[model samples]
Each structure stands twice: as structure tokens, then as C-alpha cells.
Target chain A: MNVLVQGVLLGGFYALLACGLSLMFGVMRIINLAHGDIAVIGAYLVWVLVNQTSMPPWLAALLVLPIMWVAGYVMYVLLLERSRRAGQLVPLLTTFGLAIVIENVLLQIFSPDDHSLLSSTGTLATSSISFGGLTISIFGMLTLATAVVVLIGLQFFLSRTTSGRQMRATAEDPDVAELVGINARAVYAKATAIAVAIAGLGGIFLAIRQTFNPSTGPTQLIFAFEAVVIGGFGSPWGTLLGGIVLGVAQVIGAQVNPQYFVLFGHLVFLAVLASPRGGLLSRRGRTV
Target chain B: MIRARGGQLSGGFRVQRWTRLSVVSAAVTVAVIVVLAVVPFLFGADVTEQLTSLLIFVILAVMWNALAGYGGLISVGQQAFIGLGAYGTIFLTQHGIAPYEAMILAGLGAGAVAVPTSLIMLRLRGGQFAIGMWVVAEVFGILVTLDAGLGGGTGISLNGLDVFAPGYRQAYTFWVTLACTTVLLGLVFFLLRRRIGTSLQAVLDDEEAAASLGVNVVRSKRVLFVVAAVGCGIAGALYLANTLFIQTTSVFGVQWTAYMLFMVLVGGLGTFEGPIIGAIIFYLIQAQFGDSGAWYFVGLGATAIAFALFLPHGIWGAVDRRLQLRLLPVGYTLRKLDTPASAGADPAATDT
Candidate 1:
């Protein structure tokens, strides 16, 4: 039960990691293999805020969100606008290139070392509550709560807000949306920005949970990939569910053999693929 | 493999004789093979070894080109077969089989392995398909490391090659590599000239439309995947033959897959000569500047970004447009006669 509870908490964080990746895929149909590498940039942004100012984590995280959002927008204008250019930057090609550049950038700046973000709010991460013999970290709760709130906010933004509907409309029919006077490029840019904004939040969670170095970012992309695949592409709630399952698998695997944590996650990942219907959760719609 | 269907080159005048130009081409190939075969005795042993490795990479790149450019299946995990092929040959040699025999086994073994990987992984489409295959390659790497029979962290070594003389072994490896690369290039060219290759192009252009056209999409793709793996397997065996060793990191080095993909992409994938051209250029670049480490990757990354952003067609694609010459023509085009002789001369003559 304790393992299960802890697993669930860890899953919450994985869900957070996956949401941005899934969202990007949903709207733009871009893999953004550089997604986690971009998150690494966000992590460093918070690192700078925390180290130079020694600011609290939450405050630093909050401060960096707008900046990260802008970075996301710039990335959109520069990278995502040209679909042909986007295609040329296939996962193995351009994303691999981005990984090298970002990792090296972090390495050069941070000197290939691990850095930490001290608690932003007093004991925010350390604080925990006990329930039924399982002690749950408050930051874990924070992560879970953040996921729900942000998801709900995102959902509301997508379904109710004018820009959100424009996003959906553009994703559905970019040419048609352009005909109607909605800027398809801006919609893509906005959706990409929202994805990166969530990634910034994920970066904070990453710093809180583990010691990170420059090269540690790509694995986040891998983990998110597994979650997204399991969740079915473009489904937000499914991404959350996929994250939790991956988290539980990792924890349980480590319990069996600590070295097996990654392998265990991969096993479950393969199992998900081995299933007769891969990405079983995506509600089949008419192909665009 | 170029497989032309339904049309004999309508007899033209002197120009139509291009089909018989194979005599000149095959002569040159034979001459090159003869030189390469004797080169161990002619050139210093060190250069021979380096050239052998280059040949191995060239073959692997060609295989990658076939899979990506011709078949339209972009797999980022091809290193799985490469590592498996290298290991397969090593294991066979450990059991006292000859090196050449081991290479044949490796080709078949690679196809065998691709079967399950394809069944499990080919289901993924688009970017997900590509990434999923890459992770699966990592899984194979991990599995190999855990297996004690394969020497765990310290991988098993190829032993039976000691039966051959050292110079003989190096020379033999070089010849085999050259021969394999030639055969692979030939096979790819032959396929591209066929109906099956056209089906592949159709699939790449539009999967569903190809299906609607009565193409047996899945089987054709799987067969090409298996064939590509076999070619890669041959390259892997030759690689081990040159080095006489294997390790998980060195054998299944993820970077090798990246290297092959870059060769195909930067050289204008789908063009037979493109990968060959890319591999040579890549070798020159790496030999000259690869020691820069992370900076080398940075430069490579920048190059990829530049190409992806600006020159998606690559060097060959550009040259193809400007010159309109195809040494390995995968698609067809209409042409006009240049001479009055074309009106009544040998109909195939106009094809030239």
C-alpha cells in the first residue's frame, strides 16, 4: 500500500512531465524531441534565479514562467512556423541536434555539474502528511494539485476561451482557419507556448525531486514519450493516467532491483506497445 | 534494386544505347574490386584497415538509405540490427566458424531479429514510430548488457579469425566489405527500378492512397525492413572483422544510427548515389574535425538545423534538379529527342 501510494505521487509528477509533450503533439503534430531539452533550459533559468538571487523555488518558478512562455513563443516563430522545416528536423535529426546543443550549452555554463533549488516556500517539499501508514510529501501533493489545476485551466482555455477555440480550430483545419482570418501561425505559437509553460513547471518539479546535470534532460523526453504513447496522443487526462502508470512501474521495479527502475519502466512501456491496440485511449476521430 | 516494368526503352537512335552502358559500368566495378582485393598488399596495412571501416559505414549508410528513402520507413533504431549483427558474427566465430560464414549468419540473424521488432514496433506511425524504435534499440542494448553469456559489460570477442593470416584477414575483410557495398548499392538500384519501389514511393507520399491503389503496404514494408537489416548486418559483420572485437557501447553506439541517418538526409535520401556521396563527405569531415568532441556535435547539430530549415533537399537533390541526371533513377520523366535520327533510328536509342 505504501509503495502504491508513493507510486501514485510519483505518477503525478510524470503526468506533469507528459502533459506538455502531449499537448504539443495534439495541436501542432510536432514531436518536439527537443521538448525536454527545452525544459532543461527552463531548469537552468530557475537555477539562475535561485542561485543568483537565492530566491525561493516557488517564487523563482513563478518568476520564470512568463520568461519561459516567451521563449516558447520565440521557438514557435523560429522553429515551428515552417512545416517543411519542421519535417526536416525529424526526431533523430534536428531534435538530436538540439539535444547536443542544449546539453553542451548547459555543460559550458554550469560546468557539467548538478545544482539544486532550495525550498522556495518554507519546507514546501519536505512537509508531508501521514495517512494509513503512508507518509506523503507535500511537494508531491503540490505536484498533483498543480497538474489538476493547470489541466482544468488549460481545458477551460481550450474549450471556452476564444483563443482556445481558435487553437482547436487551427489544429483541426489550419488552411480553413487561415481563410476565416484566425492567424494559424499565432495559434500554433500560442499552443507551443502553453506547452513550454507547463514544461517550465515540470522543471521546477524536477529540481525539487532530483539532482540534475546538463545531460539529464533527454531522459525526461523519453519518459514523457512513454507516457504520451500509453495515454494516446493528444488526450490530456490520458497523459495523466499514463504518467501515473509509468511512475508506479518505476517504483515497483526499483523495489525489485534499484538498477531495474529504468528497465522496469521500459518493460511496461514495451507491454503497452505489445498490446493489440497501441495508444488505446485516443478516441478515433475522422482523419484530417 | 531497379526493377523497370511495362516499358521497353522505345528504340531510339544512338542515344538509346545507354542501357548497354552497363558493360562500361560493370567493367569499372570489376576493376575497382580487383584493386581493392589486392590493396592489402599494395597499400600499408593501416590505410587498408581505415578504408575497410569506411566501406563498412558506406554499406550501412546505403542500407539506411534504402529503408528511409526508398521504403519511406524512417527508423531511428537501426543500430539494434547493427549491434546484433556485429555480435552475431562474433558469436559464430567464437564457435569456430569462418569469418565469411559468420557474416552470412549475421545477415540472416539480423532479419530474424527484425521480425519481432517490426511486429512490435512497426505499429507506431509518424514521429512516434521513429522514436519508439530508438527506445527499443536501447532496450536491446540493456538486454545485452545483462546477459552473462555475451560477457555482460565486457562483451565477447571474435576468436576464429586467428585461423587466417593477419594480412590475409585484413585483405579479405576489405574485399568482402567492398563487395557487400557494391551488392547493396546494386540491390537498391535494382529495386528502385521496379514496381515494388514505385509502391514504396506511393506509400511514402500517401499511405492510405497507396493502400487504396491495391498496394500490399505492410508486407512490402516488412520485406524491405528485413532486407535493410540484412544489409546492415553484413556491414556490422565486416566492421567486427576489421576490429576483431565487440562491445555494447561500441557496437550499438546510438551515434552510428545518427551518422547513417545524417548521411542519407544530408546527401538527399532516396537517391542511391546520395548516401554514398554523404558517407564519403561524412568520413572526410569526421577524419578532419571530429576530434572536437562536443563541439563537433554542435557543428553537426547546427548543420542539421541549417539543412532542415533551409536546404531540405540536400546536395544531391539540388544537383538532381540542376543537372537532371540520375545515375540511379527511382522515378521517371519525359524527355524530347535531340536528333532527327530519333524519328526513324533504333527506338531504344532515344532513351540515352
Candidate 2:
């Protein structure tokens, strides 16, 4: 039961990691192989702010979010926008290339050693609450709460706001949206901005929860991608469910044997692929 | 439509598929092959080893081009088959099979595994397919790590090759590498010349139209996948033969796909001459900068991105367009006579 609870909390972190990926794919039809790397960049930014400037971790996260948003906007405008028109494979390869560049650059700057934001988080990293033979780490609960808030907040913004509707309009049919005077490029830029801001927030949570390195981005990407796929590609809430499923599977697999943990998540993902519905909660069969 | 020429109507016009450039290129290619075949006798062991690596890379690039450039299945996980091939060779050699025979079986083994893998992987489209392949490769990597006999996370070396003299092994491996490159290139060329090649082109251009036109999209993709797997598998076995060592991380690394992508994109995607040119370009680049650590990868990734964005057709494509060169001339091109009547007519009007 404790393992399952811990797994659910872990799922929240995975969901947070995957939401930006899901948003980018939903709005722009880009898989964004660099998503995880960019998230790591966000974490590194926070690390710099906290350690170099001696700022509080929360304050560092707060400052870094806008920077990440602008970075995301620039990344989309400069790199992805051009490749998006080339072909289906071009954007993917472009992002993959970008991922390599980002990872290696990070490696060069930070070296291959691991780093953590735990020290910056003060007692938040060690705090926990006990109830009915179950102890929940305060950081874990905070991550889960943040995930719920972000998901609900995004859902509301998308369904209610004017710019959000415009983003949706652009996603559905770019030409139609253009004909309707929606400024598809602007919508894309904003969508990328929000997606990246969310990823930055997730990165902070990730750094607090675990140690990270330059090379960890690929593994993070694999986990987030598995969550996105298992949750169904486009749906945001489904991503949370998918993350939980993956998290639970890993925990159970660990319970059986530690080596099987990651393998179990992959097996569940493959099983989902083999199913008739394609994903656990996907509405449509085609990915786009 | 018949053209009246010199008071006589001509009903037939010749369609020239082969250009002078193609003929010259073919002659040059044969000459190069002849030279490569005799290289072992002329060069020392180190040079032979380098050439063998080059050949293996060429095989990989060509097969990858055939799969992605032609078949439109941009897989990022071909390393899976490469790893499988190496492990397969290791397993077979551990049982006392000849290393050369084990290499062939490794190719077959990879192809056989690809059959079922394609069934699941082919269900994805475009980017999903690419990521799905990466996942499958990850799964394969993990599975290899779980097997204790396979050295788990660490790796093993081929043991039986010690029976042969080092010089003999080097020469034999070089010959086999050359032969594999020839067979893979020949297979791609053969496929391109047949109707299947045209169908593949049609499918790549537009899947819906090709399916409507009776192209078996799934089956063609499956064939390409299996063929590519076999090629990579063979190359993987040769890689072990050359190094006599295999590790999970090095063999199953994503760096292989990065190199493949860089080569294909820089050379030209979807062109026969492109992979050859790309492989040579990549070999040259690697030779110069491969020892530079992370900077090499940074440069490789930057090059791939630059090519993807600006030079999507690659170097050969740019040259082909500028010079109207058709080195492999697999598609038909109708050339018109200098007569005024044929001057603005449709190029496809000529049929013979």
C-alpha cells in the first residue's frame, strides 16, 4: 500500500514531465525529442539561480519560468518553425539533433557529473507527514498538488479563454484558422511558451525529487514519452492517468525485483501499443 | 499522339532512362569495387581495418536510406538490430561456430526478429513510428542487460576468432565487409529497378494515393524493415569481428542512429548516390574529428539540423539538381528531339 502511494506520487512528477510534451504534440504536431533536454536546461537554470545567486529555490523557479517560456518561444520560431514545413521526419530529426546539441553543450559546461537541487530546497526535501501507517513526503505531496493544479488550470484555460480557443483552432486546422484571422504563428508561439513554462515548473519539481545529470535527459524523455503514449497522445488528463499507470507498474515490478522496474513500464507501454484502441484513453486512432 | 516528321508520321519515341553520367558513374563504381577488393593485398592491417569500418558504415547508411529515404519509416532504433546481430554472433561463436558463418546467421537472426517487431511498429505513423522504434530498441537493450550469460550490463567478446591468424582474420573480415556492401547496394539497386521500387516511391510521396493505386503499403514497408534489419545485423556482426569486443552501451547506443541520420541527411535522403556520398563524407569527418570528444557529436548534430532545415535534399541532391545528373537512373526520363514540334509538348508524351 505504501509502495502504491509512493508510486501515485511519483506518477504526479511523470505527469508534470509529460504535460508539456503532450501539449506540444497536440498543438503543433511535433514530438519534440528535445523536450526532456529543454526541461533539464530549466532545472540547470534553477540550479544556477539558487547556487550562484544564493536565491531561494522557489524564487529561482519563479524567475526561471519566464526565461524558459521565452526560450521555448525562440526555439520554436528559429528552429522548429522552419523544419515543421519540411516533412514529417524533418522536424523529428531536427529536434533529435537539437537534443544532442543541448545534451553535449550541457556536458561541456557542467561536466558529466550529477547535481541535485535538494540542498537549495531546505527542509522541504526532507519533510514528511505520517497518517494511518502511511508516510508521505512533503515534496511528493507538493508535486502531486502542483500537477493537479496545473492540469486543472490548463484545462480551464483551454476551454474558457479566447487565446486558448484560438490555440485550439490553430491546432485543428491551421489553414482554416489562418483564414479566420487567428494568426497561427502567434498561437503556436504562445502554445510553445506555455508548454515550456510548464516543463520548467516540472523541472524544478524533478530536481528537488532526484539527482540529475546532462545525460539523464534521454531517460527522462523515454519515461515522459511512455506516459504520453499510454495516456493517449493528445489528452492532458489522460497523461496523468498514464503516468500513474506507469508509476504503479514500475513500483510493482520493483517489488517483484528491482531490475524489472523500468522493464515493467516498457512492457505496459508495449502492451498498450498492441491493444486495439492503441492507447488507454485515446479518442482517435491516427496520431496526426 | 503521332508526330509528323519530314512528311512522315512517327508513332514511336524512345524513352531514355540511362544518361551518359550514369554510365560513367557505373564504370567508376566498378573500378572502385575492383580496387577495394584488392585493397587487402596492397594495404597493411591498420588500413584494412579502417576500410572495413568504412564499408560497414556504408552498408548501414545505404540500408538506412532505403528504409527512411525510400520507405518513409524514419526509425531511430536501428541500433537494436545492430546490437542483436553482435549478440547473436557472440552467442553462436561461443558454441564453436565459425565467426564468418555466425555473422551470416546474425543477419538472419535480426531479420527474423524484425518480422514480429514490424507488425507492432508499423502500426505507428511518422513521428510516432520513430519514437516507437526508439522504445523498442530500449526494450531490447534492457532485455540484453537482463541476460546474465550475455554479460548483463557489461559485455562479452567473440572467443572463437583466436583460432585464426590475425592477418588472415583481418583479410577475411575485409573481404566479407566488401561483399556485404556489394550485396546490400545491389539489393537496393535491384529493388529500385523493379516495379516495387516505383511503388515504394509512390508510397513515400503519398500513402493514400498509393494505397488507392493498389500499392501494398504495409507489406512494402515490412520488406524494407526486414531488409534494413538484416543489413544492420550483418554490419553489427562485422563490427564485433573487427573489434573482437561488444558492450551493451557502445553497441546499442543511439549514436549509431545519429551517425546514420547525419550521413543520410548530409549526403541526400531518398537517393541511391546520396548514402554513398554521405558515407564518404561522414567517414572523412569522423576521421578528422572523431577523437574530439563531445564536440564531434555537437558538430554532427548541428550538421544534421542544418541539413534538415536548409539542405533537405543533401549535397548529392543539390548536385543532381544542378547538373541534371542521374548516377543510378532507376526512373525513366523522356528526352525530346530538337524538332520544333516537340519543343513545348509534355515530356511524358513520348512513349516507346
Candidate 3:
């Protein structure tokens, strides 16, 4: 029971990390292989902000969000925007190559080393609550709470905001969106930026929890991929469930033998692949 | 139809068509090999060794072309089997089999491994197939990396291979690579001409339509998958012979996949002439700026993006379309469709 409880809390962080990725993938149909790397870049940004500005983590993240948004937008314009019209192979290979370049560049600049940020007392990320015998870490709990909150906000934004409806419309059919006078390009740009900003926050939370380096991106990317695959492609709520499953799997595997951490993750991925549809999530949501 | 297209050649190069091109290509390839064969005697040990490296690269590129271009499999994971083949050869030679003999055997073994591996994986289609192959490669890398005797992460050396004396090794490596390339290319042409080739081409054009035509899509794909594994296996053995070792990082390097994709795509996909053209062009790119680090990969990516967008037919694809060149001679040629009737005056003469 304790293991399940602790695992569920940790699963919340995975949900946070995976949501931004799945959202971007959900809307754009682009994998954005640069996703984890971009997140790492955000982590570094938060690191600099904290060290340089004496700002709180939450406030510093607000400062970092626009920068990440621009970075994502620029990356989209220069790399991903036109890629939409290209064949499937084009986006897959180009993004992979871009991932390699970004990771290596980060390595060269940061020296393949790992670092973390110094947070103040009661930051909620590191604090935990103990009720009865099972103890829930505060940061893990906060990340979970934040995930639910942000998801609800995103759901509201998508449902209530005109821009969000435009995004959903473009995602459904780019050609049709053009007929309705919605600029598909602008929609894609905004969605990518939003997804990237979420990724930024997710990365910061991740860095707070673990020791990360440039090489860390691949594993996290794979984890998010598993969530996206298992959750199905387009459902944010499904992604949360998927993240919890992956998180619990890891925790349970660690209980048996820590040596099998990666192997377990891979096994789950293989199972996901073996499913009838391969992707558990549907491409769209509706009664039809 | 054959005569009509053959007649367009006013020069000797086109005079005999198949017979002449075969004779000419064989002559040119042999000439090049023979000259490179004696390079150790002409220049020095170092240059001979470098030439061997280039030949090994050419073999790898051509193998990638078979899987990607001919089969339309587009695997970014040839390194999976390449790494397996290298370690297989290294482990075999450690027990006293001659490296050359083991290299051939290793290729056969890898082909045997490939058929079933591809069967399990063939369920995946398109982007799923592409990423699945990479995932499979990572699995192989991890499993191999856990082996203690194979040196694990530290890797193993070809001190295990005692096939030839040190003095003659590099030159021998060069000849073996050339021979492998020749044989692989020969096998490619043979496969392409078979009924199997037609079926495979049909599948590439449209899977459902091909299946409806009674093409055994599964068998064709499996055979090509196995053959490509054999080709990659031999290339891996050759790479080991040249470098004299198999480090986990080097043998399983993603760079091999990158280079292979770069060569095949940049040169051309789905055409025989493309991979070869790509290898030469890639060699030139490496010679010029390979030492510049990740920028070259970025540039390669940019080039692939440009080709995928505008020139998706690839360099050879472009040249083949624009200039009507079929240097590799894999596909059969018919007379021009617009050509007015000549001696036969048959309307079907213009049919492709």
C-alpha cells in the first residue's frame, strides 16, 4: 500500500513531464524530438535565474516562460513549421538529427556534467506530508497538484479561449482551418510555444527531483513517449493515467530489483507496442 | 522496346546495352580495385589503411541502400545488426577461426538472425517501424553491453583475430572489402531482376494493390530484410578487420546509422545508383569537414530536409529523372513513350 501511494505521487511528476509533450504531439502531429533537450535548456534557464536574480522558483519560471516560448517559436519557424508539408520521413529524421545537434551542443557548453538548483525552505518540491505510516513528499505532491491544476486550466483554455478553439480546429484539419480564416501557421506557432512553456516548467520540476545531464533527455523522452503511446495520442486526461501507470511500474520494479529499472520501462514500452492499436489513445475525441 | 531504347545510344557505351554496360562496369570496378589492391606497394601503409576505411564505408552505404532504397524499409537502425555482426566475428575469431572465413560465416549468421527479427518487427508500419527499429537496437546494445567477456562497456579488441601477418593485413582488408562490395552489388542486381524484385517493387509502390495482385508481400519483405542483414554483417566484419577492435561505443555508434542514412538519402533512395553516388559524396563531405563536429550532422539534416521537401527523389533520383541516367542498371528500360513508330510501327512500342 505504501509502495503504491509513493509510486502514485512520483507518477504525478511523470504526468507533468509527459503532458506538454503529448499536447504538442496531440495537436501538431510532430514528435518534436528536441522536446527533452528543450526542457533541459529550460532547466538551465531556471538555474541561471535562481542564481543570478534572487527570484523565487515560481516567479523565476514566469520570467523563463516567455524566453522558452520564443525559443520554441523560433525553432518551429526555422525547423518544424515547413516540415508539416513534408513527408512523414522528413520530420522524423530531421528532428532526430536536430536532437543530436542540440544535445551535443549542450554537452560542449555544459561539459557533460550534472547540476541542480538551490531552493528555499518550504518550497513544496522537497517537503512532504506524513499521515499515518505512508509519507508523501511535498514536492512530488505539489508537482501532482500542479499537474492537475495546469491540466484543468489547459482544458478550460482550450474550451473557452478562441485561440484554443482555433488550435483544435487547425489540428483537426489544417486545410479547413484555412477556409475559416484561422492562420494554421499562427496556431501551430502558438501551440508549440505553449507546449514548450509547459515543458519548461516540467523540466524545472524534474531537475529539482533528480540529477540530470545532457544524456538524461533520451530516457525522459522515452518515458514521455511511453505515456503518449499508452495514453493514446490526443487525450490529456489519458496521459495522466498513462503517466501514473509508468510511474508505478518503475517503483514496483525497483522494489524487486533496482538493476531492472531500464529493462522494466522497456518491457512496458514493448507491451504498449503490442497492443492492437499500438497507440492506446485515439487521434481525436468525440461521440461522432 | 529494348531495341528502340538501345538504338538511342549513338556511342559505344549504349551500343550493346546490357552486355556492354556489364562488361564496362565490371572492367571499371576491377580496374579500380586492382589499382587500390597494390596501393600499399605504391604509397605507404597509412594511405593503404585509409583506402580500406573508405571501402568499408562504401560497403556499409550500399547495404543501407538495399534495405532503405530497394526495400523502402528506411531503417535508422542498421547499426543494430552491424554491432551484432562485429561482435559475432570478433568472438568467433577469438576461438581461432580465420577472420575472413568468420566474416563470411558471420554474414550468413546475421541473415539467419534477421529473417525472424524482421518478422516480429514487420508488424510496425512507417514512423512506428522507423522508431521501433531504433528501440530494438537499443535493446541489443544494452544486452551486449551487459556481457562481461565481450568487455561490456569497455569493448573488445581484434587481437582476437589472427588471420594474416601484421604486414599484409591492411591491404588484405582493402581487397576483402572490394570483393564484398562487388558480390553484394551483384546479388542486388540479381535480386532486382527476379520475380521477387518485381513483387517487392510492387509492394513499395502500393502495399494493398500489391497484395491484391497476389504478391507474397511478407515473403518478399522477409527475404530482402535477411539479405540486407547479411550485407551489413559482412560490412561489420570488414570494419572490425580494419579497426582491429569492437568497442561498444564504436561498434554500436548511432553515427553509423547517421552516415548510412546520409549516404543513402543524400545520394538517392529507391534507386541502385543513389547509394553509391551518396557514398562517394559522403566520403567527400567527411574528408572536407567531418572533423568539425556536430555542425556537419546539422548540415546533413538540412540537406535531407531539402531533399525530402523538394528533391525527394534524391540526388540520383533527380539525375535519373532529369538526365534519365540509370548507372547501376538495376531496372529494365523501355523505349520513350512519345517516340513515333519506327520500323515496327507498333503502338505498344511506346508503352512503359
> Mind giving the per-residue lDDT tens digits that candidate 1 earns over B1-352?
2223324334331222123334465576678778777788888778889899778778888888887777767777788888878888877776877879888788789888888888877777767767787787777777888777777768777787787888777877787887787777788777766677778888887889999989988877887888888888788788888888788977776677668866777777777667877888788888988887667766666676666566665788778767665554456543434467565533321121
Clashing pairs in 2: none
Chain A accuracy of model 3 expressed as TM-score: 0.92
lDDT agreement of model 1 with the native: 0.76
Q: Is candidate 2 or candidate 3 better by TM-score?
A: 2
| Native contact share for candidate 2 | 0.74
Query: Per-residue alpha-carbon lDDT of model 3 for B168-247, expressed as tens digits?
Result: 77767777887887888788878976777778878877889999989988888888888888888888888888888778
Give residue B294's error in model 3 in angstroms: 4.2
Docking class of 2: high
Candidate 2 chain B: worst-modelled 10 consecutive residues by lDDT:
B1-10
lDDT of 1 by residue, A1-288 (tens): 877777788878888888788787777777777777777787888888887898777788899899989988987787667643345335445666666677777777787777766444467767889987888888888888888788778888888989988888887888899999999878888888988989988987888777788877767888888888877677778787888888888899889977678788888888888887676476675111
Superposed model 3: Cα runs more than 4 Å off: A1-6, A118-126, A153-166, A176-182, A275-288, B1-27, B38-43, B94-97, B193-209, B212-219, B294-310, B332-334, B337-352
**Superposition error at A277 for model 2 (Å):** 0.7
Model 1 residue B285 lDDT score: 86
Candidate DockQ values, in order, are 0.50, 0.81, 0.33
lDDT of every predicted structure (CA atoms): 0.76, 0.87, 0.73
Choose the strongest candidate by lDDT.
2
